[model samples]
Target: MPGSPNVLDLVHRSCTDVAAAHAEHVKIDDAAVSALAAELLQEREDVRAAVRGLPLPIKFSSLEQELTLLALYHLLDFGSGYDPLLTKTSGGRDARETLLFGLIGLHLGGTRMDHHKLKSFTMYDLYTTFNIEATQEVAVMPGVTMTKPGPLQPHAKALLTAINESGAALEEAGAKSPGELLLSLAEGLKKAGRTTAGAFVEELIDSLPGFRDSVLYDGRTLTLHRRAQNLAADLAIVYGGRDDRFAFSDVDQLAADSGATTIAVLRAKGVLQLSEELASTIDEGSELPAGPHERALRAAAVAACDRVVAAAAAQAAGSAEAAGPAAAAAGEEGEESGAAAGAGAAAAGAAAEAGKEGAGTGAGSTGPAPFRAVDVGAFLAFLTEEGRPLHGKITRHVTRDVTGY
Candidate 1:
């Protein structure tokens, strides 16, 4: 068995030889094909037995056998003497990727076939599913991200484009690493049965803290929460388990894990807010938000809200653009003064105004532009006077107030 050929190689060779013999004897008898098939199976078993003596023998499992059977059915459906799963109705790229991977996985000894069960898969299957050369090329690119756009044919272009654009931002943010985030986004796009925008939001979380922080703080802001819930519910329906994070834990624990001292702290930080009585009621007996994945899920809600705000801003911009010169001027002025929230260029003006009143200026401006530069430190001081605990934690000095940076 040490010198014997690999079991799979032996089986495949036997099948090929038998098929050739059957073809040669076709004129003699229909029995020839049956005989050849029987011989192939017999030889396959013999090869398996012989290989058992070797250190690197292939093993078999029922799930693997089932997949092989599926592959056989697929091939037969394609009119090949050997089963092939190709079909005209199969949506192009996804179908091709699935067919190639599925077929390869069937031949390989070990593979996790279920989509929901994301265990390790065969190297052979991986190579088949993803083109090794293309992947290698992408891997070496300056700032590339890859996403698997799923089995649907229509969204491949959009999926690729999005990964290329957003992948860089994600890498910069240090949320999820670029590779994992890219694949996650791709899977969401392909299988989550959500809009492209919804999928994009998932990508945002993997790529940007603003989105991640937003998601952790709130879930009602974007359709992403709905889409994520739909995906979670779909998984529960198909897999016979609960995937909703809210069901896993309570508000108090969720707040604690999310970096707040209490449910009250969560409310004060705008992470969670409820009426005092309701809070008390839930606190008396409510599920605790536990697990890292659950926390991420809760965070996704807030991220969705951030996306909604962004969309609203863009819509407002569009409406303003249609309103003509005055609107355009206002928009440009807003950008320079940091009225366009999160603009980095306005930081200079903001820094100047931190301790004292200062004027802002734009690229082409002759004189200093009139803008309020409030001292965030002083602002915190005033908030501290109001007895807001968050004032003490405002050392990062982010001016979330859109009136200034």
Candidate 2:
């Protein structure tokens, strides 16, 4: 059975179009093509045996056969008998690193088939679908934190949308389904109606033996993801030189920083306008009493400057925390000097100098920038006291506050 029907021959016979597409699009040649064929046969067989050997608690015997049947169908689903599931839509990963990885709660087996799923796949996919049905963590911000959502979560919705879009995209490109379903039961479940949809998804969880044994996927990729050195550079490249951080946990920092910047800019602009108008009033021989607009602008400017200072100091505090005792000791000495981002060139210069000192460690691994400790609570209180009347009013004028990073 290892070579029966000869995997290469099967590729030639059943998956000519897929092979051609790979060569045409991905530029994979003879070796890549043959290697793919062998892997499919070997993995599919291994999966078949695993499912057969599984101590299925319920009447899972039929389910095992049905699941294998799905794998076999997935490979032959595409014209040329190519496995459609093998094609990866995007090279870069997203929350939980793509829908497939997110769904399974694990990355299983070798990555040879990672760019694509082996087939609609064996129990791996089934387990992923099952995992989807349970309450899973939805990444509100990448690498930072996860918010747990109930069944039918946001990630699942995103994944479903992606899949639908993919199918539509392919169809638009002049390919047809050939009436083959990604999952055999999906169509039948549809015909049976939406009421059965809940039950169908729930059934998948009960059928997953791999979950019990914890052998479903590899945990290495999901664990302990730390911030990369070039994170700031990469974010700037993708988002275009914004005062933002893209590390999974930096949404809070981005929000605070953006808020501070916004206040600063708005206040500077408003104060200039008010001061100009007031100066004009004085020159024209009018009274020096400030008008409502002038007062509001004055308050807004103060509030903005305050927020900017607080946010910058907070940024420094974070760096200090990351740098451990040395940063803390160094930061304590520098706190009285106002080491905020408002200091601009000086703070950045310090960070660069630190980089030079840390040169032997690794380029760009110069470690965290210099941080200043700021008492945010006391500063906020002073800010509110100085600009209380119009502070809240000015905040209400913000038209857009994008939270998702």
Candidate 3:
């Protein structure tokens, strides 16, 4: 609060600091991403009209599902030359978006086709399956343009696996409406296969409103992560947190969960790009090394958390200093009352002086209530690592105190 600009400036410094720190650790690999592109991928008009106009047997049961599907599509909504984490001005989508689309696709459409069935669809065939012909391309969010790549497309192959399965099953069973199919399919899939995509879709559909909400949640989450990483890069430029192990370690301790190792913590924070599973573990996964840019993003995010903690500490210290005089006066008054009861005015004056000395000593010696920046690692955890929001009010406190950018 005292120095809003200084806190905001940390965003820039954290970028440089993190980039230098993770220069040799691991970086983002351009090839790993195959779908959307950047961390926060970006669109929707004609697609919405097309989705509405389609005469599909089983449409989305709820508006939430439809919206989630649309957002997912918009993210995949990429063109040629896609790379995750890249600037919108430079080209297409970035790696994060690509992976997101990949995840959504894999989760819904799946990578494998069902040869046993006469006809099968994946998430990619969004428009065709639905009879929504004539895909329109437009500029989505963040200014990167792409086609109607969402699930509600002309072909509905890889759209929502849940909606597709419900529809397909309903078609086979001669079910009448979309809502009925969703309810029946969701209830019937309880004992479905765990490894198969169809079963996964069934489980998702079974959850209904909550499932769709989760997708929306995931969208907001990934976006926040992307933005946080951008700020992290900015901070790295100012403070070289990654360059020093000690500095990084301080961040790692605050940002990491209990019993997490150095590399594990870094990976969880997205500073080290390993397999998602391995990233949560104590050991690094044997996967493709991350690129420097991605690593720098994580480094910056962590460094930014550390800076927030330091600021909180400083603020608490300042408050304590400001309170010293009031505390001294209170002590003086108490001492004066006690001495007046037992001794003369001369003694009371001496006692008052003693109280001032004690207050000064107490103020000087008492540390700032063991300054614990409870929210220091909250945003990092929310974005990179999986954890609760920062402790108590500090969670929101950082918006004004730590993050102005």
Q: Specify the highest-lDDT model's number.
A: 3
Worst 10 residues of 2 by lDDT: 220-229
Better of 1 and 3 by lDDT: 3
- Residue range 290-383, candidate 3, lDDT tens digits: 2333333344344433333333333334544544554555557776565443444444443343223211101112332121111223222233
Which prediction has the highest TM-score against the true structure? Answer: 3
lDDT of 1: 0.28
Of 1 and 2, the candidate ranking higher by lDDT: 1
User: What does candidate 2's lDDT look like per residue over 246-308, in tens digits?
Assistant: 111221111111122222224323321234554455335443332233223222332232233
The model with the greater TM-score, 1 or 2, is 2
Which candidate model has the greater TM-score, 1 or 3? 3
Collision count of model 3 = 62
How high is each candidate's TM-score?
Answer: 0.18, 0.20, 0.24
Residue 304 lDDT, candidate 3, scale 0-100: 35
